[model samples]
Target chain A: MTHTDNGFSATRRLILQGASAVVLVGLGNLPFGLAPAFAAANDKYPEEAFKAKSEADAIKALYGKTPEASDKVKMDAPEIAENGAVVPVSVTTTLPDVTSISFLVAENPVALVASYKIPAGTMPSVANRIKMAKTSNVIVVVEAGGKLYSATKEVKVTVGGCGG
Target chain B: MASTIRVRATSSGETTEVQALIQHPMDSGFVKDAKGEIIPPHFIQQLTFEYDGKPVFTADWGGGVSKDPYVKFAFKGGKKGDELKVSWTDNKGASDTTTAKIQ
Candidate 1:
């Protein structure tokens, strides 16, 4: 059928675009010729990654690879958070060609806190507020130059953030 | 309804800095209300910032993010008086978008 041929061509084009679009993530398996039209739409949400209950599973779901620990990935977090509901965390990486950064809480019910995509020309630093259920180690992962690096720190919470 | 997003974009010659604060409960579904019933998860799943029609920064968030989330980042090549677009879509499919002029 002619429609089959069109679908094949469209899929090929989508693959090519995915290869070039560093801003997009985890969207390669979307089917149908209509998928390419969505290239301009919002990026696909990683529902599975957010649902991972541990840090290691989350990192694998999001990036499909493991990251090496590195000192260059600097994480700024409070030694003790007065309010667990709004613990301010940030990261700045000295690594080159940084493409993405992610946060994970080793003790939270869902370990993955936040993940960010850094396009070309964007600075390699990001700051945000997150929640911690209790005292836990906060890990930051930086993806740079086709490789992944990470840093971690312990943050103590006086009170629980996920509703004690 | 008034938009729930508040954004400020400032360009300093070479780099542009953006800070945004969004009003949302960001409920992690792990909490209970006064009646002891569980609160279902309601959180923003994705937030994007676009300049010159290209995404400079994008955030994929989970319920672990704080309520009324605030985030900051910077990128190169944004010009003064230009426009930057900020938008977010929550898990329930609710979305809000707004544009801010660079200063």
Candidate 2:
């Protein structure tokens, strides 16, 4: 029993030392750990796309061109969002070659709420729950025939979701 | 490790509707924690839906989304027993994936 007691203390001390070493290593790599996370998040997409303050600018930054209002695209949203945090919005199009669909909440801090890439043979329709900072126009941009088209609808919200 | 996602997909009338509920804090980095410290940004940035091997629907999300994000979207072509894979990557470099079969 006496011999085993010494071994137990030795093992406990070793574990404590190992934990301290791990903590020191983690502190040493703090800068590297945090930098890659931010780089990865921003590197996946253009920084300007999300920072665009207006719907038009977001569309341009996202698609590299302005969109024209077209009747072929259908934008659907509630006349009033009961909950601004989860406003259901959808876009459908009858146009051929619908490549992508994007949603923008003009009143939010960041205008571009969502951008969807629709592959061929898949439906040209998408539904998503987006946050509306306030009462604003919900814009849907669709890319078809190598051109950009858009549709807009106003959604009134009583509660602001963007940090409100 | 990131949180889990529950996915369900059903096909009807030549269309498949996919719905997924992702468990996440969705910290906007604007909210403060118990100690008044700003919770660093940790939210799913992108989510992708794939059928078989092709990408059908993808979403670029931000931290403004509510907690425990729920998303639903539909696509044109899908059949019963077809596999639908949903994957997501967060700002913290954590990722999660789950799959369901069209019913």
Per-residue lDDT tens digits of candidate 1, residues B25-101? 99999999999999999999999999998889999999999999999999999999999999999999999999999
Worst 10 residues of 2 chain B by lDDT: B25-34
Instruction: Please provide, for model 1 over A63-125, each residue's C-alpha lDDT reduced to its tens digit, 9 standing for 90 to 100.
Output: 899999999999999999999999999999889999899999999999999999998899999
Give the TM-score comparing model 2 with the true structure, all chains together.
0.76
lDDT tens digits, residues A29-141, model 2? 89889867654553365557877888878888888898899999988889998788888887888999987888888888778877777777777887777888789988999
Task: Judging by DockQ against the true structure, name the best candidate.
Answer: 1
Chain B TM-score by candidate, in order shown? 0.98, 0.93
Clashing pairs in 1: none
**Worst 10 contiguous positions by lDDT, candidate 2 chain A:** A38-47
Best by lDDT: 1
